[model samples]
Target: MAEVAIRGVHKSYNKVPTVHGVDLSIADGEFVVLLGPSGCGKSTLLRMIAGLEEITAGEIAIDGTVVNALEPRERGCAMVFQNYALYPHMTVAENIGYALKVAGTRKPERRARVAAVAQSLGIAELLDRKPGTLSGGQRQRVAIGRAMIREPKVFLFDEPLSNLDAKLRAQMRIEIRRLHQRLGVTSVFVTHDQVEAMTLADRLVVLNHGRIEQIGTPTEVYRRPASRFVAGFIGAPAMNFLTGTLAADGRIAIGSGAGTPVTIGVRPDEIQLLDAPLKGTLDFEIELVEELGTGQVFYGRSGEMEMTVMRNGGGEAALPRSGQRLFLKIPMTCVHLFEVESGRRIDLPPSRLAAE
Candidate 1:
């Protein structure tokens, strides 16, 4: 295991910057995930760590040794690619043991190590099989085994499960986490999937337009987003946004037509349906209802502003359907306010928002 440090790292292609100056310190044996949308420089940053891409500026260190000048193999990093980059002609044993063979290790030792790794990954029976004969998950296990046999100080995954189906992806996620627990190797994973990032990361590094947006544990980032972009990007169905103004009375009026302008955000699950129009409640007209197995999602609008609300595990009789008008009580404790110009979050006391 190794502590990976990236300090003031920058990458560019032909004078057009792909990754801005990024500084992150990954603790030894920590599982850090770089998460963002496509073209957000997450992959570029991961490649830089693996020595696959050159750093335009700044230095990277592994286990306290500066590795900016080192070759990919010299950095003590083993990378598992998304495509399962295995030789089709080679059997699983040969594929996993290839690195040892290249380093001039004896065949008997190589076979022993390959068997051990295959056994650990539960692919020992498939050691004689070729890549073409294996399923996607099996091929991925072979790829992981290939990386594992090297016993590198660091493991890098570049969206390795993106090619699998949903069920296989979930299974691989658990397997990867188990491997991390059993081996305790320092790992860095890059992905555009929030679910993958949330489930796999000890800490998530959120990136956007070549810059780091936020770095925190999944719950911290979800419960208290630093910016509007993060609040919108991290949740399912996304957070609902409204243009409003904070009045002197500490109450928020739900439209631009009033008070000191600010942006309000609330998650779909945070809204409470009301029996009557309370002083702090907003009027909503339900246009559609979606019945998910665990809950129901209501899509509607409050005046001209579109909104979405989620109700978890309620009976059909207790739920409202399309064409129903309802009142929504947005608790001040659950509300997030942001600056209209900067999009940064504003922290407010609940007592200040009490209904008059």
Candidate 2:
């Protein structure tokens, strides 16, 4: 296992910057995921670490050795791409053992190692099957097996499960995490899927446009987002955003018409439905309701700002339908206020502002 360090790394294409100067340190044997939307430079950063892409500036070190000059093969990193790059002509066992074969290992030792890895991944039975004959998950297993055979100091996954169905992806996620636990390899994974990032990462490095937004454990990033972009990007259905001025410490009046110009965010699950109008309650004009298996997502507007609430349950309980009105008590602690200009979080004490 190796600790990977990226210090003030920058990458640009045709004089247009993609990865702005970024710094990060991934611990030995820790799983770090680079998460962002398309064009966020996550893949670029991963490639740079693997020596597939050159660093335009700054230092990249693996196990304390500066590797900006090393070739991909010399970096001692094994990479699993989004597309399972298995050779169609080779059987699963052959593909998984290819790296060892290239390095000139004896046939008997190679075969033994292949068998051990295949058994670990639960794909020992499929060893003789070619890539074309295997299921997507199986092919993915072969690809992962190939990477494992090398036993490199670092493992890099670039959205390796992106091609699988949702169910298969979830299953493979568990497999990958298990592999990490068993092997204890330092790993860096890049993906736009927040669920994948959340489930697999020991720590998440959230990127926005090429810049690092926040780096923390999944719960830390979720519970306390550093910026509006992070607050909206990290959650499913995204965080509900409203434009209003802080009328008081815990109160916000939605609309540019009367309040201060500030932006506040709320997690969909944090919104609480009210049985009756309370002192801090606000009216929500319901526009839609979706019955998710775990709960319901309510889409509505308060004044001109749209709001979404993820209520716990599989049915219509505690939710008003379209064109109806519902009262909600958005807890003060759950309400996150951001500065209008920079979109940074603003923390306020309960006694700081006048009560509504």
Candidate 3:
């Protein structure tokens, strides 16, 4: 395991910068996930660390040594790409040991290493199968096993589970985390899926466009997003956004147009739908409802303002239905406010908001 340090890294194509000046540090044995939407430069940054892409300006040091000019093989990092990149003609065992064989590792020692990696990945029995015969998940495991066979100091994954189905992706996530635990190697994973980022990362580096947005533990980013983009992007079904101004009367003044606005964000789960209206409570016109087994999300509008409220299913309370008129109690403490102009979060005194 090794500590990976990135200092003021920048990358460009045709003089147009794709990765802005970015600095980050990965502790030894830490799993850091770079998460964002497509075209966010996360993969470019990961490739820079793997020596597949050149940094326009800045330093990438692996295990305390500068690796700016070093080749990929010399950086002591193993990468698992989004595509499995397995050789179709080779059996699982041959594919996993190819790196070692190319480097002139003795056949006996290489076979022993391959066997160990396969067993560790729970794919020992599949060693005889070719890539064509295996399932998507099995092929993915083979890709992982190949990377593991190298025993590199750092592990880099570029959306390694994107090729798998939903259930397989979920299963692979746990296995990847366990693999990191067993190997204790410095790992950097890039993904656009929030679920993957939340479940698999010790810390998350949220990126947008070509720059760093926010970097923190999953809870920190989810509970207290630094910006409106971070808040909206990090959550599922997206955080509900209501454009209005904080009025002097302690109410949000939402008009039809996007006027001078203060954006209010409400997590779906934090919204409470009451059967009767209470003082300070707002009205919601329920338009649709989705019950996704584990929970239910209510989609509706407040006047012209759209919102969603999430509630646990199979509960005692009657589920709110479409066409129903429900009063919403927006807990002040659970609400997030942002400056609409800059799309930056605005911190209001929680105690003060709660009291109002």
Candidate maximizing TM-score: 1
- Cα RMSD of all models vs. native, in order, equals 1.6, 2.2, 2.4
Error of 2 at 189 (Å): 0.9
**Global lDDT for candidate 1?**
0.92
CA shift at 280, candidate 3, in angstroms? 1.8
What candidate 3 gets wrong by more than 4 Å, as runs, is 246-261, 314-317
Tens digits of per-residue lDDT, candidate 3, 1-356, equal 89999999999999998999999999999999999999999999999999999889999999999999999999999999898999999999999999999999999999999999998889999999999999999999999999999999999999999988999899999999999998899999999999999999999999999789999999999998988999999887789887767754444544434344688898998888788999867889889988888998888888878888887765636777789999988876787888878888777666557665
Q: What is the TM-score of each candidate against the true structure?
A: 0.96, 0.94, 0.94
lDDT leader: 1
**Superposed Cα deviation of residue 69, candidate 1 (Å):** 1.6
Per residue, candidate 2 scores C-alpha lDDT tens digits across 99-135 of 9998899999999999999998899999998899988
Q: Give the count of colliding residue pairs in each prediction.
A: 0, 1, 0
| lDDT of each candidate versus the true structure | 0.92, 0.89, 0.90
Candidate 3 lDDT at 48 equals 94
Off by over 4 Å in 2: 247-260, 314-319, 349-356
- Clashing residue pairs in candidate 2, if any? 245-260
